[model samples]
Target chain A: MSELHLEISKVGIDFPTPKGPFCALQDVNLKISKGEFVSLIGHSGCGKSTVLNIVAGLYQATTGGVMLNGREVNEPGPERAVVFQNHSLLPWLTAYQNIELGVKRVFRGKKTKAEMREWIEHNLELVHMTHAMHKRPDEISGGMKQRVGIARALAMEPEILLMDEPFGALDALTRAHLQDSLMEIQTALGNTVIMITHDVDEAVLLSDRIVMMTNGPSATVGEILDVKLARPRNRLELADDPEYNGYRTAVLRFLYEKQKKVEPIAPKRAEKAAEKDSSKQVA
Target chain B: MSESTTVIPTVSSAKAASKFPTALVSKISPAKLRDIVLGTCLPILGLVFFLLFWHVGAQHIKTSLGTFPGPKEVVTQWNNLVAEQKDEYAREAAFYERQEKRNAEALKEDPNAEIKVREYNGRPTFFNKIQTSLFTVLSGFILATVIAIPMGIVIGLSQSLYRAFNPVIQIFKPVSPLAWLPLITLVVSSVYVSEDPMFSKSFIISMLTVTLCSMWPTMINTAVGVAGVSKDLINVSRVLRLDWLTHVRKIVIPSSIPMMFTGLRLSLGIAWMVLIAAEMLAQNPGLGKFVWDEFQNGSSDSLGRICVAVLTIGVIGFGLDRTLLAIQGYVNWDKSAVVR
Candidate 1:
């Protein structure tokens, strides 16, 4: 394997609730190498976003911590750029200006005025959003706005990109288009990325490794699958490939047959129901 | 023979239509015509009907001075006020010219003569009173905005500060301008003593009263606006690790602008209303005072002039609100969003 770039060790977080402390995650551990694309996939409420948030330094883990390039991650920084679900583009700023904001923040004393402008234009070109560069977020379509969001995160030249369901709000076609763009960009840049997603196909299509999480009330990594697909993958050709189908079935079996989703009944009610079943068996 | 005659008439009609630009007529669909009638024509018609009602109603109600002034009499009074303002300007110009001539003559006669140029102490015309009221109201509004917006931002950003200040804001919000006028008057009279006072006591009193009564809406609305910034944007700020001032400037101010403008418009409306009331009660030299003085004059023309002032006040208030609305629309980035 390559050099260890990021590490999540003994991570757990307990949120204070009216019912006392509720553990959302516990003993979650993962090690990622440089230039690796990792996807965290699980059922809803599985604390997949929680793990990404912890890595992004937006949330502090109660037990352990996240390390980036051998430094403890405590607070958010421009080096760890996040592409949020809703695009999170400032409505008041144009697409180009939104990218400019992060670029200016990251490249302020390092890049000259013309260099920054060229860099901003290049990132927009990378996402194929140079045409709508001057349009505000409200004026653009949802998919276009998400493209700008990606461009903004890319323009920062971050060490690691964090995406929390970046395409969840988009239509299926738009999602596919964005996924293709993301793959192209990732291949070209070789940037480290950690994305949270619910779509199994999306996880398999993009990730170097998929980290499947268990259902929460203390959710942790259930399994990790390494995809050894060749680079420069074509989704159409891979659809008919036997190896691709094998990997897809493996993930499906793990999600449905092995770690099946259960209805979250209250603890006391579950206990009482279990007692009734055992008593009936005794009778 | 009948078909040939009908074709000839149609050709002539077509020629006529081509000469007159028939595209405009063709463009007005039934819906477009209805919009024109409802949007433009109906408002004009309503105003005409209102004038007619007032003209008829004025003759039947006899007031203490005389019959209430009708539209015709109000128009005459408006013209008279304009002429009076012109005369006042001419007098002011003549006063300055005479002072210059006298000073030059004295300097020529005694090479070191001390000459004094006196200010024109003429009675303020109707237009002058309008200017005074505008100036006072604007000054009060600006003063309030400068103090309220920053304070509101701070209070909104902090939970404990909001808790501490909320009761005080609520208590003072509803206090009337009239209630504050006497206290403001007394305070200005005592605290503002000087050898040559920069502002009149009545002006200060009216302005302070306007400020006190009008500032609450802006402060409260701004606080609400600042507190209600969307969580997604806040997360973006956190992820960016924006500094405190940068966060406030980039995220807080832009998102809260629409609500802040709403507060500003409301405050301005209240400020205008409070200034007039304060001016009237305090006998300050403004349109309010003019109306009060005309009522006390008990002359036949006085009622008509008072009617003119009333109309002018309503028009000015409407104009001020429209101006603020235009400004709000300009500053707001979401052009598709209707500001009102």
Candidate 2:
């Protein structure tokens, strides 16, 4: 566990806009050991997901680069599997076929067809999605679709897993359920993972290290808080625990007090925020 | 939640709970009664109204040949046409039997005698003309699909190639089959040379004209579909490290099938229309030709026969469209797609 499994050294990404080149992220540095779970949390448009995409090799970094297991990632490969924010499973394929597509392509030389089927079932079982393996994405709910997305990513036996807001679109109870299952799956598999999220509780509950990002147009890592909570932590216990509250408070402070100045793009949102600030002062 | 209002299940459970609504509907006799009445009675009433108006209008109309044929006259002509086809078949069978008997007799009397079978040359019936028209249109449609689909895929995948061919497509798309018929006829006549041709020249002319006019819709639709593939799906393909062939096969084709089928349906419509026009103008042996001949015949029953041909053409066009829609429903993975 002491050895680094993945490194993002001073990576920067720039997208061309009509006016000029917009720098979404700059000089972002992250390092993870073999079994670490890290979360990048910030406001929307903070380039947290941009950083994850760079690490996944889906987008090329303008300056620095990502290295996985001592190899520079120049292109996306099955070894670095990604669970996209929208659960990007092909709508035409059932859940089983979607995961099997990636597994068959990546592990063709090493495993027989029957073994691959067993591996796919095993991953689905990990995400508690074995019951709905034959359902198409359209036929299932948003949470089930995201679970299948995770199953597909893990079925490849990837060296590193990248997930972008996997449960951000679900309801509160379902999100919590998925988060718990995710933690259980992570503990059993022990794969290095980097997830992007904006939720504070999700960051604290699932990550070993929460890497807080500053807001963009030039976003970078602002703080790294190490989570020392014991393994297999209970959510209900942590909700009332003083030590967990301290960790939660620290993340909230970084997001609210330290980085409270939100640049609203829409006038309606800006008006609403102003009203919210006045209400808070009144309370 | 209120007592009367049921709690909405979560999304995952929603799938398992989908059957509840249908089950509830089935249990309600009034709901089922309303469904049947609305579905069946309304369309039948509209059709009946159309026939009544058509019959009334036909009585007042007068033409150079005679009074325009009404529904009753069209039925009479249809029966006459069916009887003519049966009589023609009997004549053909008798002619073949007589030829065989004479050839056998000649061979028995003289062992070295030559035996030659001549074809029966009876006028094609209305049903035979319909068969010819159907055969010609399907062949043209299949040929267009074979060429247009591959070409559309290539052009869609390459931006530079799309730009190069876009102007040509825009220019040629509006040209009618009538405008190309003369040029195609001349070219086919000068180019296609065989001592024993497999197809008649007039048939070739009609088929080629249908192919030319109908291929555009499919090509344009396919190009648009390929270009419009969702960005998230492309990202998924990249993440899985799918090769070019696999990406196209698994992702591009399935994703674009709905749009591709839409194009094919439009092309089929155009093919059917163009084949009828080509058959009429080129004097080919089909329904269009049958109508043209009836117009020239100018007998007392000529207008009624033309009415029968027109009705048959409309019925056949509707059947073809329904067939294509059935195929689209079966092949598309999205089972919830409403074909109508």
Candidate 3:
């Protein structure tokens, strides 16, 4: 791998609660290379979003920090554009205007007005949202809005794209469509991306490396699986490919068996269940 | 011949039956008919019923002036006021014409005489009072909007500021224009001394009273709206690294617009109401003064004229609210979302 593009070192965060500080993440570490696509996969409430937020510079890690190209990441900047799960496009602005907003901010003095317009149009075209660029977020479909959100982040020409479940809110068909488009865009731009997802197939399909996380109160990196898939991967062909299935099975085992999630039970219920199991064993 | 007659009757009856149902159904669907009835017809019917009740009830309530003026009497008085306004306009025109003639003659004689123009000193008509009330209320409302919106935004952004100013706002919000009127009058009379005053003392007093009372709703609502901006949007701003001014202009203002407008609408309504009350209490030149003068006059026409003023006030208030609502609808970008 080339020089590390982004490094998250021993990151830990404790959120203040009524019962004192609750540790959400501990000793979380990852090093992502330039143009590498990294996926953080975990069960619900495994602090996947927390890690993403810390990297995005939205939440500061109490013990350690994130570094981008040798610079310590403290506050959010346009260079680390985030594609939020909810799309987060200002409802008042049209899709084109939403992209224009970030484009203008990042390239205010660097790019001329005509150049900026072309760049925004280009980003919208990348997401296949050229037709509905004039429409507001409320007027567009959920998937289309997500496309606009991606376009907005891409318009900034950021070094890293932080997406927190970019296609999580979309329907299955739409999700597949978006995933295809995302892979195409990532291949073209070669932008380093860190995506947090719950879908096992999504992680396996898009990620260069899948970083599975353990469950929290102190969620940390459990294992890292590097997929040596060829360029321009096809979902249909991959279904029958043994290598793809092998990778998919590996991730499934890691999620289901290695870190099998136990349903949270009340202390009294757990004690009763323990007693029942012990009594069964004696019988 | 009997078979032909019977067939003709049956065919004609069938034709009539088909025509009646189709014509009614084509003209209005059940949903549309319901909307029309509920939206337009019902309101008009309610108004007509109210008018009838008022007209009948007014007859039994005899006052010193005579039987309390009914709808007919109010209409008559309204026409009388309109005629009086027309007469006043004619008198003003004559005054200006006479002055022009005098100036022309003097200039012709002296060849270098300066034309002296004077304002017409005629008594203001009912229409003039209405104009004065509108002008004063708008001035006060506009001033309140300018001060409150920015102040509200600032207070909303800072927790300390909001906490510090909330008490002051709460205390002042519930204050009556009547209570503020005397203090405003005293302050204006003492402090606003000038040889050539731009605005009348009464106008300033009434305006100040309106401003004091009407500004609270806009301020509080703007604060609430600004504070209530979605957390996700704020994060978007942060990620963009937007400067403070840009953050406010792009995210805060746009998101809080609906609430700010809500505040503005409330403030405008309060301003209008406060202006009238202040005008009545301070004897300022407005519709409120017109109503008060009619009440004091206690002539046979007095009660009827007062009724006319009451109806005019209600109509004007309704018109102002509708105007604000229209503006809100135009500016609000979320077309799918219901405004009202």
Candidate 4:
């Protein structure tokens, strides 16, 4: 019971591409305790987003699936909400309405009209987006839209929150502000979060532990570094702290130099010849 | 850049004043004004110039049949025709009333009999032609929508079904409504055969033509729309683990709505235009028929009457297209300039 809220046991993803069945993820195993913020950091196409997508059930793993709270994860449900890289808020909806949509879908029968409005507004305010709640995704800045997306997902009150580079589209300053907001929100809600990003700095700032992934077409967890920085960490203050640099340096070394230890292979050609084995998870 | 350099802090422009217009014209740029004025200007000018040319050309007309009516003469003829129609109705009413009285007198012995006149009347009046055309256009548009949307969804969902249907669609899409009209007319007439041959069969031809011609755009566009729904959006639906109905209602339709509306609008315009052309070919009892009948008359007034019919078709077609476009705008969620 005390082990982890989320568990991935030897998960692999091999998908058929035009070239062949290419391997995206390779023999990756990880665990997240309840309320832990875990970030996957790696170079582009290292399958960090693919891992997050698998957790989100946007895709499935070839060898393994995720288990949440000791139950095997099969399908996507509202209990697991996603924040996409592009902040895929339904552009047609206002911020309040977007959050309301998630709320209404998740909490269908119990809440009264006033209660629903209060819930939506409360989440919007949590993301510091109460004032811009009426704005559509296009009318507001990219950062604001992502805040709305975060609010919308959290408002669903999912058991696990999966974010796939939710702030990649925003400018640096805005990204920093959101990072703080996200950390505060995570601390308050105690959500079991698995966020994927290429930004090593973002990962170091936000995650309780950072999982650095190897370069793909066959990728795996190369290293896991604990972020031993103190709580309620301020971005600029943490940047100046020497401990943050130590963790960042470890991640950088693993990403740039230590990646050479993993062997790379052509994954597609193998999958095609073995297509008769229908159980192969072409995720 | 050089001319506008001095105007930085001023409320008014400090440019060479002659290059710009007075206060009123300068308020909105000439380019913007041109856009507004151009919308109405060319059509009005064309009408005026056409009338002038016709009026001059009318003088040279020495036809074997009779003198052709000028635009002014046509306006006078139209007024006289209105008067003649009123008189005709009055006479016809009086004639009907007398006939009714005679029938009533004769019906002293036969009260169960149907009302019968000496001649067949109620052939479509001029206004009735336009009304029937409008009715047929709208009804056919609705029918096309009913068949196309679901079919499009099916095709969009299945690769094999899409492949199977592709050849059928391709073959039918380019075939003109005129080609379909006779096939439609003959089939309806034979299959819908009745004791009295009461069905016009023209109605069937017009409706079928509308369906055939309009179906392609709606089918193709709706399939494309459904296919183009974002993968990320679908993932949200999946993670929410939505039911099939919920996926369609919450995600699929909303995402595909803009494209669906585009399909509907395109098909409607196509149906409206095609119905008229189809009617003309099939000799259907519609505005197209009215024009054909007018053209067949060997009189100088025929072309002028044809001109009126042509004008009405254009106006009605424009009105329908605008109405559909308005609906498209209303239904579309991504109303901003950008889709993504």
Candidate 5:
């Protein structure tokens, strides 16, 4: 097997809050193999987005490191392209122009205007967004805008694509539709992908492997499940499948287990506190 | 998903259907008539009530000016002005004809005559006042726009300078145009230094005052607009490695235009208001000056002519606002960019 295309090592992130430090993620380590689809699933605010942003170089790791194809990640570079949850498109640009801007920037000096247009058209068509090429962000539906964002990201032909809950803001039906479209596109292109999602069903359906994070303030990798589902999964058909239930149950259990511990009012292990007090008294 | 994704292709179709709003409105079996009536009733009712009160004020309650002429009086004054305009036209024709005959003989002797013909149409017609006011308003507006937009962009782009200049702007923004008129008059008298004595002092005063008053809103709005562009868009510029000029062209200006237009609209409305007030105080030959002149003359139905001036002001103001709005809609191109 080819070496992993993107590796995140010993990563931890702390954010400043008014009251105190907020530990969003802790001791996070992962490697995404070439041509593999990896989905990081956790409860909302499990710092899944923080981890994705770190990989995208939008945010830096406090202590650990991010490496892409054996190079150290310093800041945002064209090798990693991100599609944000909100589409993050320039509201002023047409879909065609937005994609063209991405392609022209990444493939600078390699393509002419006609060639760039062809590249934009190819990716737009891949996401079935050819008709919306001339449409502005506001002129299109939320789903359509997300498709344009996806097209723009894919059009860049980056080494690893980092999606920060790309479909989290959509309706269930639109989410499912985009999931299918994403699967189709991923199969054709086969680039390394690290997607951040809170939806368990989304994780099961889209990923070769799911990296589930424990809930914060010091979140860790709770479980990593291998989804052995076959290719070209029908979203509706797979949801009803017995095997789908097995994967869903496993993720659900891990989430609920840490969710019980990770809440603010939850009782801690009584012995640990008692032991801490006794040790303090002896000291 | 029942091909909900197909909606992306027909966005323009949706937009076109949305333009009328009555069709899909009915398709949804909406209570659209109720909505239209509900939406329109208040403004319509407000207009009716306004006219009614105004009618009563002009007909019954005699102000210090004596029975402020109602809408009927206004129509009459308008017609009288129209007749006076026609009579003036005849007089102008006679003056031109007499002068042309004299010039023709002179020109027959010297074909390349450098003759400056003057027809002194004293109490030059009401139309002339409108033309004067329009020219002053247009000239001031163009000059303000030429200076304001680039300045606004520059101030808006920089954080520290924006903070530094804000205090001075705040100090001056609310100061009345009337206050600036005396100062501008003094400056222009000394510094303008043009020997064109035929150039009306009132015209220069109104223009200078309008330029000062109207330029602020555009500056403030453009700056705020540029500053308010999404951080995400800024990050995109960084990643794309676009230079400073590209960043401004592709990101900043387009995002700021709607706000800039809002400023322009506001500035224009203020400019007209200021120009009128300046004219009123200074006896500039515009609508406001016309009103002041009539008030001073106190002619029979002088107040009626004042009403005429007021009505003309409202109509002209409305026309100017709509024209700016039309230009805004034209340049925006992306219909979604409109505020409402």
Candidate 6:
């Protein structure tokens, strides 16, 4: 096996709100090896996406840092391509043109025009978006638009692919279809990936390891569950498989049982008040 | 899943089909008569009603200049103006012929004779005034667009530049063309010194005044548009590590196009409006000068002629706006955007 490809060590991010500084993520650490698929899953507003953005270098961490291939990540570059949740494809450009934009930037003068055309076409075909290549983003369906977004990310041939809820906006069936295609592509390319998703099944089926986060104001990693599921896992076959269900259950337990609280800070305050009374009686 | 995905491509194909002009309704379709009536008949009816109102209102009004000229009087003056234009053109042709004949005779008598073919000094007709107005306004508009677009891009790219420029832009934006005319006229005449100038001082004054008043909209709109480019697109550019020039050309300009065109359309409208006022106040040779000249003459026919000039200005302004609207449709990426 190859050595570690990405290391995010003790990253904490803070945003200034009108009230004061708001902590989005805190004390987060994770290491992803080459060709590894890691999913960061948590409830909404748990800073899972924030962690992904930090790794992608879209957001700067207030404390700690991210090291990609032994280099400190400070800014975004072509080596790390991101598939945004909204499918951020330019509305003015066609799918082919959008893909070409990244390809031209990454591989300018390195490949012949014919080779570049094949590269773009191959990527489109990878996501099965060849038929809608000529249509602009507005003219395509939400699902097709997302496929083009994925195709664009793949076309860049990044060392590590970062996706922030790539299929979060699509309908269930479309999302499932995209997930299957993603699994196939991941198997074929063996690219390192760090995806942020909330779906337990999606995390289990697509990831080698799932990194769960506790609920935020200051969210941190709660647990890391390793999925030992076999490669080429089928969505239908995994429905009844006990091993697959076991991984899903373990994640659900960590999220719902161990980390469950109605209010993030109120319970802690109540416990502090009880401790104060006990201390007064002892004195 | 296949069935659902197949369903979406049909929608795109249908949209593409509907995008054609002929797809409004086929020749074989049953609603052709309705389309024609709605398109042409209603507009004609509105014009007829307007003419009726003008004719009826003219009878009741009594101004010191004279009774207000109605549609009939205005049309008669318009016909007279057309005849005058034709007569002026005939005189110009005769002037050229006489010059040519004199030049030939001089050359025949003395092979190296210093003979010149000078332009005819004749009174400009109504049509000539229209031409002058169009030429001046378009020159000013093109000048404004050239300066405003690049300036706008620069200011939009940097927050500090925008902040530095914002106060100056806000101050100058509201200054009227009328107020600027006197200063422009003095500066133009004093600075534009030449024995044989390509353009007259008055023309320069009017053009500069129009440029000053009209440039603000385009500049402001461009700045706003460039600054308002989607954050997602900005992120994409950052991730791609595109150079500054490439980022602007590929992302900023294309995304800001719709807003930029809106500004251009507004600036053109202001330029046309400002040119007329600049011409009227500065007494440059345009439709504005014709109107002012007619007012000074104060003859019975003067009112009618002034009416004709007013109507011509309105029509030309409409035509210029329509031309820009058509251009906006052509240049804009979003074809479905309603430019009108």
DockQ for candidate 4, C-alpha atoms: 0.53
Q: If both were scored by lDDT, which would come out higher, candidate 3 or candidate 4?
A: 3
Candidate 6, pairs of clashing residues: none
Which candidate leads the pack in DockQ? Answer: 4
Residues B238-295, model 5: lDDT tens digits: 5555677878888889889999999999999988888889888767788878988888
Q: Per-residue lDDT of A8-92 in model 4, one digit per residue for the tens?
A: 9899987765556677788999988888889998876677877886787666688888998898876677778999888887777
Please state the CAPRI-style docking class of candidate 6. acceptable
Per-model DockQ = 0.42, 0.37, 0.46, 0.53, 0.19, 0.36
Better of 3 and 5 by TM-score: 3
Given candidate 3, what's the lDDT at residue A28?
94
Over B1-340, each residue of candidate 6 has an lDDT whose tens digit, in order, gives: 2433343457675455544543543333558767877889999999999999999999899988779999999989989999999999999999999999999999999999999979999998888899999999999999999999989988988878999999999999999888898898888889999999999888888999989999988998899999888777888988888899989998999888888888898999999999989999888899989989988989889999988887888888899889988988888888988877
Clashes of each: 0, 0, 0, 3, 0, 0
Predicted candidate 1 versus true structure: per-residue lDDT over A28-141, tens digit per residue: 999999999999988877788878878987777889999999999988887899999999999999999888888878898999999999999999999999999999998999
Q: Per-prediction TM-score, chain A only?
A: 0.93, 0.92, 0.93, 0.90, 0.90, 0.91
Q: For residues A1-283, what per-residue lDDT tens digits would candidate 3 score against the true structure? A: 5878999999998765444566778999999999999999998777898899888888778899899999999888989999999999999999999999899899999999999999999999999999999999889899999999999999999999999999999999999999999999999999999999999999999999999999776889999999988979999989999999999999999889988888675532433343334323221
Candidate 1 chain A, which ten residues in sequence have the lowest lDDT sum? A274-283
> Candidate 1 overall Cα lDDT vs. reference?
0.88
User: Please, what are the lDDT tens digits per residue for candidate 5 over residues A123-219?
Assistant: 9999999987898888899999999989988998988888989998999999989989999999889878899998988999999999999877777
| Candidate 3: residue B155 Cα off by (Å) | 0.9
lDDT tens digits by residue: candidate 4, B54-172: 88987798766566667776676566556756776777788888888988976876887676677536556667678788878787888888899889987875667888898898898
Q: How many collisions between residues are there in candidate 2?
A: 0
TM-score of every model? 0.89, 0.89, 0.92, 0.82, 0.81, 0.88
- State which candidate has the highest TM-score: 3
Candidate 5 falls in which docking quality class? incorrect
